[model samples]
Target: MNVSLILIILLVGAFATYLAGDKLASKVALLFSIASLGFSIVLLNQYNLGENINFINQWINQPNVSFALNADGLAIAMLLLTTALTPIIIYSSFRNEYKNAKSFYALILFMAFAMCGTFLAADGLLYYIFWELALIPIYFIALIWGNGDVEERKKAVVKFFIYTLAGSLFMLVAFIYLYQKAGSFLIQDLYNLNLTASEQLWIFLAFFLAYAIKIPIIPFHTWQANVYQKAPTVGTMLLSGIMLKMGLYSVIRWQLPIAPLAAKEYMYIFIGLGIAGVIYGSIVALRQRDLKKLLAYSSLAHVGLIAAGSYTLTIDGLRGAVLQMIAHGFVVVGLFFASEIIYRRYETRVIAEMGGIRSQAVKFASLFMILVLASVALPTTFNFVGEFTVLYSLSQINVWFAVLGGTTIILGAYYMLKMYQHVMLGETNTKPFADVTFNEATTLVIIVAVLFFFGMYPKPITDLITPSLENIITQINRIN
Candidate 1:
């Protein structure tokens, strides 16, 4: 079967979930998500065996656009992350009672479908369509199901919508220009263009605007904390865990390849911006009294490092970025899930309102502690592998970049450990804080297991992504 099969499954699953009505929505969604995951596994096996899984067909003849889904090892890795996490994310929400549950779960599946399409689309216009499609579901999901004041949530969601949409238009323009120059919107065609250095610089800037706003690096990150805090936990997980990676992945897959000269020429500036985000996000996270907001800032820090690694134009840098992206995805979701669990018991997001939970819920405390350590990139955790590789790559460029980027681990450890102590330790809360239920424990255990397993044996992922990353690196240095 072709790569499009996975997309079809998720798309149909969204409709099936909505038709199942509110009562059966979660179960239906989870079942379909698992099916998609299973299919992806089968596809992976086929891919490894040298079967043709890529799909492409003419869509717009005049514009020369094609509906293409290229399932190379890199795309497959991202597709697997989206498919695998979709089930966990859906099952995790089984604990909460959302109103109009059918629509909520349907939106989740639809978003997953769009995200998978984004990862797989090999045509520029087609990829843009999927990219924008992913935004619509999340907008409604956050605006409708999100917690907090109505006005604030609306403002946050709307602003995020406008910011990302506005930035994306610049990318669309760049694509249109490339289509005119190359007479095709295919990725490989654009990659083959012999543009002037000036053209590459403008195109590079256009893409940087879109990716920066989405990745929300530094000054462009104003909307992130508010949106993260206001959106429901599910939306937060989708955003921090998977959606943010879209931008980072695009840098490797689209931006650098299309404008290799610009990427190489201005590498240090972009890397500096990413490093700035690292320092800024860490310092801000240190002061956040709100747990989700703290996690949100923490995400900002991690992605910044990932971005820096991607821009380094080295195999280690790109490979490390991909590894960290996957590692961060699972750990961040687990951390946010921990917050949701605490909120369930106490119905509060304020760190001050939580205390002595460890005494009452030993299982939860231990799991949350593992997630925290994973976040700070503890040795033997998946995060450490990625972080060490990224830091090493940065050092290859400039030792000081490595030193500054390394603050994420140091400041990250201090803030996360301090957060865990205040929220889980000290005097027991008067309210009965029950231990994690079977479902909750299952989700965290799965995430933790993946982290530790990959941390020790990352050869599989490294092997999967390295060749693709090396090709991109070759493209970046082709002129040199």
Candidate 2:
């Protein structure tokens, strides 16, 4: 079957599942998710080992928008990540009793559709539409089903929506300007269009705002903590695991090549923000008593380094950033799931509320420990591979820059260990927490397997990214 047909079927399956009653909704959703995963694997197999796939036809000839879908190594990698995680997420939520199970499953499936579209979209306008489309379902999921006070959840959802949409509007305007100049919305056409330095700077700024808000860098990151705190476990997993990567991916795909000179000239500004986010997020995380908030800040710090790496425009930097995006997604999602387990047992996310879990629940404690180590970039974990490459890239740019970026590892250990000690260690002050169920254990084991597998043998992913990175670097050098 054709890949596009599979995508349409998956979308339709989601709605069909929604129409099904609560008893069968989750099962149907899981079936569709598995099918999507299978289809994505087939798509990966169809690619000529190291080539991209593009499907294009005319949509609008005048302003030059096309119904275009393309997937390179990067897009395929992200697609696999999305499809692989959806089933896990759906399975993770199996124990819960949602108010409207059908709608919940529908939203999750709809989110999958939007995310796939975002990664596959080749036309500028088409990409934007998919980009914005991804945000709405998540907004409702968080608002309707999130934890915390009703007012607080609403506020958090609104803040996240407004911040992201505001930046995206600017990005839409930039795309329009680029269309005016290039007479086409095709990504390649935009790349080929020569524009003045001043024009590039303005367009870069516009695109920067959009991705920055999504990435939730310093000053623009106020919404993330609250959103992460309030969101349901699945919602939080989707946002941290998949949605944040969208911004990082955009920085590499749209920001750099579209305005290479501007990126070069303003590299320091981004580097500065990246470093600031690192320090600021770390310090804030150090003070966060809530597990979710701490993870959220740590995410900011991780992405800061990624943003800095992208600005370097070096092969190692870009490759490391992409790798780190994948690593962090897995690590953060695992950590968040760990938090959910604790919350289910203790009914509180406050770190200080519980202790002595290690003795009572050895498996849970062990899994949490492994995830924490990964979060802090331990050797033999995927995060380590990504961080090592990124720091090496930063060192090439400047030793001090690498040093500044390296501080995240230290700070990461400081907070993560502290949180672990507080939550998983000490005297048994609370009731004995139950051990992880088979399902939960299986989910965590899968994540750990991928984390270590990628960490040990990063060559496949590295090879997958190298060709595209080479192409991007060639363009950067020519434009420079």
Candidate 3:
């Protein structure tokens, strides 16, 4: 229950950031985010000693739902990822001067709160509530503050809002079905339900609709590139870095376990869909002319591989998916932030419009190159471990699946290298390009350092996530 302290700090931080007003909002949010990270690390220490944190309060009676939260190995690992990213995200925003700074920063903290709740919630209704709560702030963050033409922004924002919301409705229906069957809204209770094959398939698809739009496998991904391009850089970072993982995490925590029979019955179909996204997204990314949109497609390819891994329903696959989730979260934020840094100086995002910036910004170019390499799953980068594991998992499923998914490595390198050459190498831009400022440098340094450190030594995180994933696989296999 004491892990409730983690959520408490984030929620209070949101309000405190708002009340602190424009002058101190970002600073206050940063402080609170750091505190949240510190507390989560402490909790992880406790978790190591065979301990967990769970909090419950009596709430709804008709549906038999309660406000409940628990931090197990899997939950805490995600919580750690959420809390860890919040401060880095806030710090990355320090150089920008946001209009209505209090509201902007407050929304960021609010998002952190909701996302943390989603990760920690132990009850089905509570998780769903937190899940929906996350969409509100991001909507405003994009709508009020997005870029491009106002009408275009509206179209993209509304499309994104409607798409995700519509997906959630199906999920709510599934949760209601589970509630009826189990007579309780606790996740474990739903997991134990003895639903027949047809019911499991229906429930599986319902959850899949919700999560697919969010993780956005293949065709469901139309909303992504536009939103990433239009939204302000911070919003883009949030969406790519942490929000997308919500769906992937749900697949592991809720969808697969609750409907294992259906999941198994359709495993190949879903896995094939995920691999398709990998190939389709990578192919599309190879053609994108805009920086943000290109990264958006790149993200799609990466997550597709991760999803394929999770669907494999094996220890290696699930472990790789979790590790890759964390890795992708970090690298994408760094990549998008690099784009933001360039936009700040050049006032453009078109790849053709940018060229040879390394002449002036050696430090920036080096860091950007590292991130680009990491994105392509370069050795000695954290991404390699995740990519290798996911591909290995897919190989176990079908060698061809791994071969198809592995195109990301080739295509990722093609686009990323082409990007780096056009944007940073060759003839220098005629205009003077300034080097990264202290704050920008600080952010990039932290990102690169973490990527390298974990790339070298991944055992800590792998160990942390394995036990929970093992138990999950056990639940999944029991259905067979």
Q: What is the TM-score of each candidate against the true structure?
A: 0.99, 0.98, 0.99
Candidate 1, 1-480: lDDT as tens digits: 999999999999999999999999999999999999999999999988999999999998998999999999899999999998989999999999999999999999999999999999999999999999999999999999999999999999999999999999999999999999999999989988999999999999999989999998988999999999999999999999899889999999999999989988899999999999999999999999999999999999999999999999999999999999999999999999999999999999999888999888999999999999999999999999999999999999999999999999999999999999999998777789999999999999999999999999999889888878888887877763
- Which is superior by TM-score, 1 or 2? 1
lDDT of 2: 0.89
Cα RMSD for predicted model 3: 1.0
Off by over 4 Å in 3: none
Instruction: State candidate 3's TM-score.
Output: 0.99
Task: Report clash pairs, candidate 1.
Answer: none
For model 3, which pairs clash?
Answer: 1-54
- Clashing pairs for model 2 are none
Q: Highest lDDT: which candidate?
A: 1
Model 2 C-alpha lDDT per residue in residues 310-412, reported as the tens digit of each score: 8889999999999999999898989999999988888888888889999899999999999999999999999999999999998998899899999999999
Error of model 2, residue 367, in angstroms: 0.8
Give candidate 1 misplaced runs (Cα > 4 Å): none
Report every candidate's CA lDDT. 0.95, 0.89, 0.92
Better of 2 and 3 by lDDT: 3
